[model samples]
Target: MPTALNRRSLSSLAVTAAAAALLAGGATAANAVPAAGGATAQHRACHVHALSDGRGAEVCRTWTPHGDGTYYGTWQVDRADANVIAQGRFDGKVRNLGVQGSYSRVKDFVTRACDSSGKRCSSWA
Candidate 1:
């Protein structure tokens, strides 16, 4: 009978430890911000710049949710900019593109937009 009781006590202790671990993990997940495709969208900030020639540029910086250590950016231009960089249908024209960083720093994937004249540009996002 004593051996059976000891086994029962050990089993109860193991279950309690597992439950505590699960609770701790749940609390951490609850505090995290939702991802982009989740119920809540990732936070973002936008900026627009115009040139003397009546052309404009726009850029946005999107922060990653918790557990991700990087950020992303998007850019658009009404005309064209000499310094604008993009691929596949983007040429500083009236188009926008989303870019992400492979590393942990936002600067790893900075985006720039400029007017047609190339003299004016939106700050890197």
Candidate 2:
């Protein structure tokens, strides 16, 4: 026979374990590829437009997937001078027709520009 406190502790442990398992299953499901022509085919590569400082906006070229929807690309800004910006490897996903991902620059040129302008910016630096 166990005390009420012991039963409560066991119940709490069981609940925690169940929650962890559920979360792991959910993560696996999210990464799983759906049936072809069903939903996976509808997932497009993620893209981001070039940032403009109002002088003239830059044009971002199309990016192609490297592997498993991950992409690597580059964009050139031809405003004051020709500047090349490279986007490193990034993970892409599609959820309900919406594409999202995390992208980082291979270099710190963008952040340097922002910092020079005295504007607060977030970067890997």
Candidate 3:
């Protein structure tokens, strides 16, 4: 039997490994396809990350296909004091969602954006 901590470590490792594989696959697909003249497709993946201990904000956005091409997205923000919550969707499209919260809760911040193209993008500050 493994301890709780050990199990957690293993779980994290698994997640990391899976993410890496997805990213690698995405890169291969991107290279195979041509994006110069909209040849590949309009579908895209966008990752966003934002963090600020003082006064700042983060934003992430991606262009979905003209209609039902595929939409996958993620957004994250962190401030002096805030709680961090991450979300992901396999099939869903919600746009222009506004954000509001107190900035006296979190210490760090992170934002990740992923789409149907298997492209994962993120930013941190």
* Top candidate, metric TM-score: 1
Query: What are the clash counts of all predictions, listed in order?
Result: 1, 0, 7
Better of 2 and 3 by TM-score: 2
lDDT of 2 by residue, 61-100 (tens): 2222333444333333222212323222222221111112
Tens-digit per-residue lDDT, 54-78, candidate 1: 5444543443333454343332332
Q: Clashing residue pairs in candidate 2, if any? A: none
Whole-model lDDT, candidate 2?
0.26
Which stretches of model 3 miss by more than 4 angstroms? 1-27, 34-38, 52-125
Q: Rate the local accuracy (lDDT) of all candidates.
A: 0.36, 0.26, 0.28
Who is ahead in lDDT, 1 or 3? 1
Give me the runs in candidate 1 sitting further than 4 Å from their true place: 1-41, 65-68, 72-109, 117-120
Instruction: Give all TM-scores, in the order shown.
Output: 0.32, 0.25, 0.20
Worst 10 residues of 3 by lDDT: 1-10
What lDDT does candidate 2 reach at residue 75?
30
Please say which candidate is ahead in TM-score: 1 or 2. Answer: 1
Supply candidate 2's per-residue lDDT for 58: 25
Tell me the deviation in Å of residue 34 in model 3: 4.5
Candidate 3 lDDT tens digits, 1-125:
00011111222333444456567774332223233445333222223333332222333322222223332232323221233332322223222223422121222222333232323323321
* Model 2 misplaced regions, further than 4 Å: 1-56, 80-115, 118-125
